[model samples]
Each structure stands twice: as C-alpha cells, then as structure tokens.
Target chain A: MGALNREQKDMEEQSAKHKVVHYPQKKNKVKRNESLKSNAIAWAFLFPFMLLYVWFMLYPIIQGFFTSLTTGSFGMAREFSGLDNYVRLLSDQAFWQSLWNTVYFVLISTPTIVIFGLILALIVNAKLKGTTFLRSAFFMPYMLSISVMASIWVFILQPYTGFLNAILGQLGVSEEIFWLGNEHLAWISILVATLWWTLGFNMVLFLAGLQDISEEMYEAADIDGASAWAKFWHITLPSLKGVVTLVVILQSVASFKLFGQPWLMTGGGPGDATRPLVQYIYELGFIQWDPGYASAVSYVLFGVMAIFAAIQYKLLVKKEG
Target chain B: MSKKLNIKTVVYVFLILVTLVSALPFYMMIINATRDTKDILMGFTFLPGSALLENYRTMMEYVNIWNGFKNSLIVSVLVTVLSGYFSALTAFGFAVYNFKGKQPLFIFMLLMMMVPGQLGLIGFYELNRFIGTLDTFIPLIVPAIASPFVVFFLRQYLASTLHPSLLEAARIDGAGELKIFHTVALPIMMPAVATMSIFTFIGSWNNYIVPLVVLFSPEKFTVPVLMGFLKGSQVAQNLGSMYIGIAISVVPIMVAFLFFSKYIISSISAGSIKG
Candidate 1:
C-alpha cells in the first residue's frame, strides 16, 4: 500500500519539528524527568498495538522464514534441514507451473486493468452528464467480495444454462461453450471477471490524478490547436505518471496474489491449469499438510513481490528525486 | 455546436452501453433469483417470477446464509472497532511523543506494510496452531489491532491536522496523558478513522482465506466462505437458489455502497495520494 519509500524521511522531518517545538521548554533535570514521563506514556500507548503487531505480523514473518528452512508439517516436530525446502523447490514442477501461471496473470491483468482504468477515468473526467452514475456503476463491483464476484460470473458463464451462452444463442452463435472448463477460456473468463471486479479502483485513482491536472494546461493545449489525441498523449499521460506507476505496482502485486477468483469459480480446475502460486501454497500447507514446503513456496512469492515492491520504491524515488 | 452535439450523443450511447454491460449481471441475478430453477435453466428472462420465496426456501433448506451474514457482521464490526481505536492510539503516540525507538519502530511498520499478506500465511497458520487459536474467530479478528496502513494514514492525518497547542491545552487543564488522548486526540482523529474503518470493515467481511483455513465449522463460516461453501453444496443444484444465494450476499453491500459512494470514492482518491 504505502509503496512510496520516503515515509521515514517524512516522519523524521515531523519528529524534528516536534523536537524543535518542545526543546525550548526546559532545563536539564526537569527535561530529563519530562522525557522519562513521555517515554513511559508513549510505550504504554504503543504497548497494546505493539504487542499484537509483534505477535501477529512481525513474529510470523520471522517464523515463516524459519519454517521454510525446516522439514515438517504442522503439529509435527520440525527437523531443521537448512535450505532443504528451497532445494526441493528448484525441482518442483508444480511450483514452476503455478508460479508461471501467477506471472502470466500479473503480466496480463496489470496492464489491462491500468489502461482500462485510465480510459474509464478519462470518460469520468470528461465533465459529461451522468458521469456520477457511470462512476458508481463502474465501481460498485469492487465493493463485493471476491466470492460474490466469482459467483455472479460462474452463474453467467456456466455451460448449457449460462446466461452468456443464452444471449449468444439469440445472436445465432449457439454452442455449448464451457467458459471455465477449457484452460485458455477459463483464464480469459477470470480476466474479464477481474477486470469487472477491480478496474474501478484504478479508475478512481486515475480520476483523482486527472482531476489534479489543472484545467489550464488542457486549455493551453487547446489554444495551441492540439488534437484530443495529442493533448492526451502529451498533457494527460505525463501528468498521470506517478499515479500510473503506483497503480501498476499495486495491481501487479495484487494480481500476483491471485487466489480467490479462480479458487471459487473453477476451484483451480482443469488439472490446476488456473492455479496461482498462492493456491499452490494453500494446497501444500493445508491439503497436502506440508508446512515447510508451503512456507518455501510462499517465500518465493514473497521474493517476487519484494522485487516488484523494490522496483516500485525505486520508481517513486526517481520520480520525486 | 450541432456536430459537437452529435459526438456527445454517440458518447452518451456508448456510456449507456457500458453501463448495461456493467449492470446487466446484477439485474439478471436479481431477476433469476426470483425464477424457478427449471425456468432459469430453460432460458434467461428479464421478468421476475413468483418463485422468490421458493428459491429462498430451497437456499435456506441447505444453508442458513443469515447465520453466515451474522458471523461476517460480528467479525467485521470487531475488526473495525479494534483496528480503528488501536491505530488511532498508536498514531497519536507517534505524533505527540518523542520517545525511544520511535523513528525506527514507525519505519519498521511502514516496511512491513509492503510485505504481501500471503507470505505469512503458512507461518500464521502454524502460530495459531501453536497457540491453539485455530478453528476460532480469534485469528480472524484479533490481528486487526496493529493494522499498519491505518496507523500510517492516521499518523499522517494527525501530523497535518492535529496541533500540539491543543494537546498542551488539554494537559494544562489537568487532564492525564491518556485522558488527553481520549478527550482531545481521538475526536480529532475520528474522521480519518471513520474513512479507514469502512475499508477495515469491508476487508474483514470479505476475508475468506484465513477464515477458510481456520474455521472448519459450518456454523462459524463468514459470508464469503459460506458463499464458497454454497457453491460446493447441493444448493448449486438449484440455479435459482444459487443466484439468490449470491444476490443475498451481494445486494446488501451494493445498497450500502450506493449510500456511501461519494465518501468512499473520495477516500480512495485521498488514500492513494497519501499512500
């Protein structure tokens, strides 16, 4: 989420200001006492959250790394075999397939969603009538849980009795097409459902970015006889660079974590054709009862995501710097 | 002007078509939820049938979806409250106090926020099993107290909006530090907390994977998990009931989103820019 890397800098600046504001108030002894009291109070305030944060988030991250190094299932004693799971992962075919599946999804969905989002944003930012309705209609699906989105798609795309086929029948193309049965069409269906489900968030972000671009720039382009295409290519695209990068990184990270839609819609069916790496991790950990290998695969996912996140951080710094 | 009007008409027509594509599935779901399973299998229709009660009866016969709704609501509300309060307190602590390990600690939190959630799945499962909190809502709900993104947003919010003079005023009035936080800072952070709360609530409601892995009992299933269960159950035999089941899970959120569409849209905008 906070894909930008400058939060620490911003926080330091904030703390520096607070220090300057409060430092003038004291001599050494009273200031020491005051500092002690504030420190105690601050820890007390932070304790409740920090306790949970460490237990839930921070501890699990470390535990996951350790778990990846061991050979065991849950409830079994873990034998510490250093790099054993990672070594096995190198030869794991299912892991490669699922990882490739996930990468293919990220490659397809990220650009599709971002580009369509920009188009939708342009339409919404057109200052046209009925854009309010357009905005809500586009965004409304994003609020639904993934299961619900999958359900609606499954209902519409299911063979023989599917709504899509029924409509297609009337259009003189009558065939019992199993949308989720074949691997390629299943991926396409998943992509369409995903585009419907998530394109709105990116669209809303782009709309915000577009709105932030001053109208005067567009007016200036218009006076210079810039065509609509030229204005969009020059003025609009450049101004949206930051938000575009953010949305792309966020969307790729999200797409890389794809599990729910395929899980619910097709159950990663047709012989795990649509299975993403997260589902692979789930199958390993829960279904096959191998927490060690599962953690190892998860770390691979973590590695891929960390690389993307690093790229995002670099882009953010380059833009701002 | 007439040529421009023609282009406008074409654009409007295109938009209306897109809206149809967007909304048609929902309309079909709502309509087919009222149709007979046989009628639904026969062909899709725009008209509603008199089988709404029958579809609901069939769905209820298989799964008590309302129980899942209740479970989702419980988890979502608890998560929203706990995350909001603790994130506010944590943010306030970072904002007002200059303390030890404060800078590194906050930075650690920001870094952790970037780690994909699935990375910790296996370990989180093991930790719950180790602690014996498996098959319970505790795993789903208790972890909300340390939502890093919420804390980050709230901290930035306080930085720009909350003034130190106000905290000093509260302190000079003999209010204790925690009291100052409660009476002074919490109210100031309320608006930002509320905005983040909507996301927190929705996120917790839609949290399927953790609940799916943790809660094995049908009685304890959240709505999303229940919908997945419903898909696998005999209720899928009845397409009408299946449609009704999905609609039942979806329609309430749709209605609620319509109510807060403007606020939610703006929050997404603000959240993106700030993050």
Candidate 2:
C-alpha cells in the first residue's frame, strides 16, 4: 500500500515537472551568483548569534557530557570514572521507578491528548458560532506558566478543602479522595493537570491538519451520500495520518521528559508514584548531590528517547520513500 | 439538513464542555483568591467573595510577589531578546550560507533541541560553579541565548518566506553583507522574530529547574521559584494565598496572549503545520 502511494506521488511529480519544463523561459531569467553573494551577506549578519551559540549552548552541552563522567560534587568535579555512572544507574531502584512513571505518563497522556485533540479539532473545524472564541478559550490554559498550572491544580486538589473534592461532596459522594496525597492517585492528578495544560497545543496542530484537507474531498464524500461518521473515518482519518504520527511522536517524547508538572504538582510525592525519570535524575544530581548516579539515569532517559526518535525517523523516511 | 444540524449541535456541545473544563479551574482559582481560606476549605464558593484584599495582602507579605515578578521579568526579557536574536542569526546561517560542516552543525542543533534540558542539570551546575555564576541570573539568561527551537523555527520561516532575489538586489545596490542583513534581512524576518520572542519569553518566564538549581537567594528567585516557595511556606500553605500567587503568575502571560493572540496563534499553527 505504501509503495503504491509512492508510485502515484512520483507520477504526479513527473507530470508537474513536464508542465514546468514547458514554461522554461520564466525559470531561466533568474540570476544565481548575485543571489549567492546576497546570501553570504545574510550569513555574515548571523555570525554573532552563531558565536554566542557556540559559547553558551554548544560548549556547555559538550562540557556537560564530560562532567557527567567525573566523580565529585557539582563544584569539586575533576576525576573520571569512565562508565561507572552508567553501571551504577543499572541497579538504582529509584531510576527504574522514575522510568516506569515516565512510560506510564506517555502511555496514558499521549493517547488521551491525541484523541481529545482530534475530537476538538473536528468540532472547531465545523465552523460553529463563536468558534474563534472557543478556540482561544480552549488554548488559554496553555499560556499559563507551568508554575501557575501546578499552584492552581494544587489548590483544586487540596484533600478535604479543595474545590474538586468539595464539589464531589456537594454531589453527595461520601469518600473524600486525597488526590495528590495517595501513591496511585498522585500520578493521575499530575496526568490530569498535564492533559488540561497541553491538550490545546495538540488540538491546534490537529485543527491545522484538518484545514489542510482539500474541500473537494468532503464535497466528493457528500455527493457519494456518505454519512458524517463515514466521511470522518475514511477521509479525515486518512488525511490526518501524517499529522497524527507527528503529534504522537512529539507528545511521546515530551511526556517522557515529564518533570515540571510532576515536580510542581506532587513533588513526586506519596512515595514516588509521580516521579518520572528526568525528575529522578534531577533529584539525584541536584537534591541528593549525586552527579555520577544522576548522569547514569539521564543517560538511560536519553537512550529511551533516542530509541523512540529513531523509530519515528525510520517511519518518516519509509513513508517518504 | 437534520444530520448537519445534529453534528453542529454535538460539536458545539462538546467544544463548550471541554472549554468549560479548561477554563473552570482558572475561574475557580480566581474565585478562591477572592474568598478567605476558611471558606475555601469549607466548600466550593461559586460566587465572588470579599476576601480579595486580605488575600492579596497576605500573598504580598509572604512571597514578596512583586520582587519575584521583577526578577522573572528581568530574566525573561534578557533571555528572550538575546536568545531570539542569536537563534535568528544561527537560523539565517543555516538557511542562507554554504559554509563547511553546516549540515553537521545543523544536525547538532536539532539534536540539542530534542535532548531534555534536565539531562544537563548536573553538568551545567558544575560548570556554572566553576565559572562562578551560581546563584545569579546570568546562568538563567546566558544558556537560553542558544535556543534550538527558535533557531529551527526561524530557519523554516526564512526558507519559506524570504525571496532570494531581494538579497541579490540589495547586494547589487553595493550594500555590505552586514549592512544588507541589518537593513534588509532583519526587517523581513520581523514576523518570525516576534513569534519566537513570545515563545522564548514564555519558556524563560516559566523556567523552574534552572532557577531552582542555580538561584539560592530569595531576591533572585523567579516567579516559579517563588511559587514553589509559597507552596512550601507556612503562611502560603493556605489555599487562598497559593491561588493568588497562581493568579499573579498567570496574569502577565494571559495579558500578553490577549494582546498578541492572533499573531501568536497563527505563528504557532504555521510552525506546527510545517513540522
């Protein structure tokens, strides 16, 4: 099926090229070297930024890799232990727990965001009244800082006195759930907060993807007496395959690096239920002052994300090929 | 026709429901800030209350919210300007130049973007200490100056929007490379710069981990650190004070968004679509 699509695309490109070749006079008149020199001037303009990048960004990252190999405190680093950090990380229970938490977050949050994002996209794409207002309203949460998100949700999830529990009490539910205080529930609360905060971004991406689908496809579906569900299942889903893949991969990578939300919302509290891998590494490195072990945990995370990224790249290239 | 109406109604209902879910927590936060802590604990107050002044006073006294705001503004603004300009330059180089090792350099930048910032926490802290920049805003502002996202976004925008002929014409007018960049390319890239400026501003403003690790002084703490402090402090443990802090932190970003909603949204959408 993929090969067939590629063949069709190639044929379309060939025909388009043929049409372009028939109009060669317009293409030949454009001067090339003068443009190249102008580009060189643009390059010169960008030099300072490049220099700063090397100094601040590139240098720090390279230095960081080297520092990760040292066996000392943050300021007292000098001696190297080779792969000792990576070796130690293999036995750390906290590292494994954090990795588990990160995976769970990605598994739960990515799908929810993608599905909800698609649903929201479809709704807004229908051109309802106050669509623009609704779009802005939905996206408003994403504008808030992660700090604000954590603080607000912390208020809402305050065990006995919180707004959510209070509302639940009013609705005559007997049990007052300690949403952020329980081991199992803490991760859920963080996940809920994350979903609310980030769903808008994914929704916007899906909405853009939806807009890119030609109107002619929908018109064709209408003429064929297609039901709304049928049209969505056949046309909309297929049209959004590329975007869906991209969003999934992006959100998966993002969720794997989950730190701010878990840090702010629960502080990986109630016994590490919400402690993701990056947060675990952070705690080890900064809080516990164990750079060697922390570096190992970070490498583990990097390895996991690298695997996903590699898969994503392979799929993307395969699709293109 | 009935089917169309049904779908529209369903769509509207679903959107309104989700929007309410999205907006309600914020609304509740505002309302809680207006009420006393006792009332907040007793039940969810649907109506606005009279404890707003008291909560505001308490929040100010406890967290020094104004100082936090100032620190956050200073750091975010510096980071945004420096990072945005430098990233734009890097993007321009990659987009327009045929320099040696450009491809590898570009790939490295992309890899930098993908790597979680937390991975470098230990290394960065150690480096900052060696450089004697710990507990200072320099660490916060300096590293941000090489943002990979801004570089990547600016490169894509320049690739799509910039006309090569315009640069050629500027060259033909006897303009030096720097002069052409300053006089011509920079102006053309304003929209892209503005888009990235907002993102950089938000990222820097919301930055918690870097500030948490580096800035130990209370006065130097950004809003996120201050918020965390408030969460842990005795007086700030009260729901009302915490809500107020959250409200204070959210307002500036909200106001910025309201002011530049259209441009910000369009630019973001454009970036995502191109990706």
Candidate of highest lDDT:
1
Here the TM-score of candidate 2's chain B is 0.92
* Span of 10 residues, lowest total lDDT, candidate 1 chain B: B159-168
Which residue pairs show backbone clashes in model 1?
none
Q: Model 2 chain B, poorest ten-residue lDDT window?
A: B94-103
lDDT of each: 0.87, 0.77
User: Candidate 1, overall lDDT?
Assistant: 0.87
Model 2, position A118, has a per-residue lDDT of 89
Model 2 spans > 4 angstroms off: A1-46, B1-7
Docking class of 1: medium
Give me the runs in candidate 1 sitting further than 4 Å from their true place. A1-14, A25-27
In the range B104-165, model 2's lDDT, one tens digit per residue, is 77677777777777766776777788789999999898777877778777776666666666
Candidate topping TM-score: 1
Calculate DockQ per candidate and list them.
0.66, 0.42
lDDT per residue, candidate 1, A56-129, as tens digits? 98788789999989987788898999999999989988899999999899999988998899988998889898
